[model samples]
Target: MNVAIIDYGSGNLRSAAKAFERAVAEAGLDIAVAVTSDPEAVRRADRVVLPGVGAFGDCIKGLNALSGMREAMEEAVHGAGRPFLGICVGMQLMASKGREHGEHRGLGWIDGEVVPITPADPALKVPHMGWNELDFTPGRHPLLDGLEPGAHAYFVHSYHFVCADPAQSLASVSYGEALTAVIGRGNMVGTQFHPEKSQATGLAVLTNFLRWKP
Candidate 1:
């Protein structure tokens, strides 16, 4: 399988690559992986893995600089209707707007905004880090198949995805309130946590996504 790890100069591209590589190796598939900043590579991939870190506002800016690649990226995942995975702030970019560093627009692939998790109790940390349990409901989706519920995944973010349609949410993880941990609407799968850092469970998730022929 050929998996394309997109590098828009703003994501956790290196770590994402290593994670997928490790998972692919364990899965016994000689997956061809590349960390590409080129948009054309994204359009031509068998599977697309979009991962990001840093601020959402800047993430959009960096991606916009590569308009051709960005256009291709938008089409490949959101437009061309291919199987795509988004992580961290990359997942937030799937939303309509990101309110970090003022209001910024996202891909609008999913209807919602990326907002800071304003905890009722200020004692709650802003950036929810460390391993958290995923409250997933088993589905026919290939991404979740064979993956047990209440599995632990690593998370590191200040803002989280607020999906417009709750039915679209595949799973969620609780920190203060239940944050949208995963969203799988059609061929697109978005996650707020970093599966690359989630160890075995994380590897299994990525492996499932890679082998996901749908």
Candidate 2:
């Protein structure tokens, strides 16, 4: 199988590519991983991953700048039903809208809004950096196969997705209050943390994604 990690000039592509490579090796699959901005490459991929960093509006702008990239993504992920994953700001882009610097539109794949994190305790900070535990939903999700409840993942973001339907949230993290950590709807899934930097827990997540059927 071929997996394409869409390079929209916003994220750490090398790190994410390497992690997927390791996942393929560990899973003993003959999958090919490519980091490309080419829409044709994405169209031919069996699985698609969107990884982004930086401001929400900026990431969206960069993605739109690429010729045919957005259309290719919609066709492959939305129309073709290919397994899809989005990480960090990539995940935020799935929301209906983002309230980062100003009001910004997103992919609207998920019915939600990206808003700044507000900790119930003032001592907690924004950008919610460092490691945090994942609290999976009761039935959990296929993308979280090998990961257990309380498994920690690396996070570094000022804003988080606030899903309109609570059922769309697959997992969450507690930072004074519960923050959305994982989201999934049908064949698409997203994570607010960097699986590449998350150690064993992260590796397992990547591995699971590589082997996931839907």
Candidate 3:
């Protein structure tokens, strides 16, 4: 299947690319990966992976600034309803707004805000770094395929997605509180953590995305 990683000039495209390649090799699946700022590529892909790093506001602005990319992304999210996997700030972009930098609007694909993870226990880090166990709910979509309830995955983010619709949520992770780890509704899937950096569990998420018939 064709997969395109939408690079809006603000992501570590190389590592994301390599991670997908690694997953494809391991899964023994024929998949295409590209760090494309190209609108045409976004339109043509079977699935689009929107990966982002840095501040939430900046990422939204970066996505908005893309003349060709903006329309194409709208098409991917709205027109085609193509399979979407968002990483870190990319996931945050799915929200309605972000409290990070003066309440900037997101893609509005999902209703929510990306807010600072005010740790219930100050001892727990704000970024929620390193490996953490992901607990999944029962009878969800296929994206959680082969992933156990206590599966560990890497995380590196200060803020997490507080979704408006609880039903959209797929999984959660404990960091003082059970934070929303992943959410999938219809064709839109957002992850508060970085799957590319999350090793095998991360690869499984991507693999599910590649094979996802949504």
Candidate 4:
């Protein structure tokens, strides 16, 4: 099977690709992982991964600039029922709209909005960087397989997704307050943290994604 990591002029393509490769090796799967910009390649992939870093508006702009890329992704993930994973700003794009810098439209895969994080504690920072322990119900989602509550994952973001339906949230982390960490609905799943940079925990997530049927 082939897993396509779409390169939409955002995210660290090399690092993300390397992480997926490592996950494939650990899982002992003969899967092809390709970092592609071609819409056809993304549409044909068995699994599609969208990784992004930077402002929400800019990222969405870049994605829309690519002719038929969004449509291809929609067809593959929604129409074909393929498993789709989004990372960081890639995850934010799944919301109905993002209120970063200005109003920006999203893919609307999940019923949510991307808004700036406001820590409950006054001492906490805007960009919730470094490793944070995840808070999740065990066995709720396939992506969190083997990862119990308190499993650490790397994070670096100023904004977080707020699900209108809390059921869509797979997991969350405490950064002064509860912040959305993982989101999943049907065949789509997303992580606010960068799995590529989260070391062992991240690798486990990627491995689970590779073998995930839903």
Measured by lDDT, the strongest candidate is 4
Q: Which ten residues in a row have the lowest lDDT in candidate 2?
A: 137-146
**Could you arrange the candidates by lDDT from highest to lowest?**
4, 2, 3, 1
lDDT by residue (15-93, candidate 1, tens digit) is 8899888988888997899998778888887788778889999998887887697788777876767788989888888
Candidate 2 lDDT by residue in tens digits, 1-214: 8999999899999999999999899879999999999999998889999999999999999999999999999999988999999999999999999999999999999999999998888899886999999998545787888677989899999999999999999999998889999999998999999999998988888888888887
Each prediction's total of clashing residue pairs, residues at least 3 apart in sequence or on different chains, is: 2, 0, 0, 0
- The lowest-lDDT stretch of 10 consecutive residues in candidate 3 is 135-144
Q: Please give, for residues 72-161, the per-residue lDDT of candidate 3 as tens digits.
A: 887876798889988888888899899896889898888988889888786886777989999886557788888888988888888888
lDDT of 4: 0.96
Comparing 2 with 3 on lDDT, the higher-scoring candidate is 2
lDDT of 1 at 101: 90
What's the lDDT for residue 64 in model 1?
83
Model 2, stretches more than 4 Å misplaced? none
Worst 10 residues of 4 by lDDT: 118-127
State residue 133's C-alpha deviation in candidate 2, in Å.
0.7
> Of models 1 and 3, which has the larger TM-score?
3
The order of the candidates by TM-score, greatest first, is 4, 2, 3, 1
- Using all chains and alpha carbons, the TM-scores for the candidates as numbered come to 0.94, 0.98, 0.95, 0.99
Cα lDDT computed for each candidate against the true fold: 0.85, 0.92, 0.85, 0.96
TM match of model 2 to true structure: 0.98
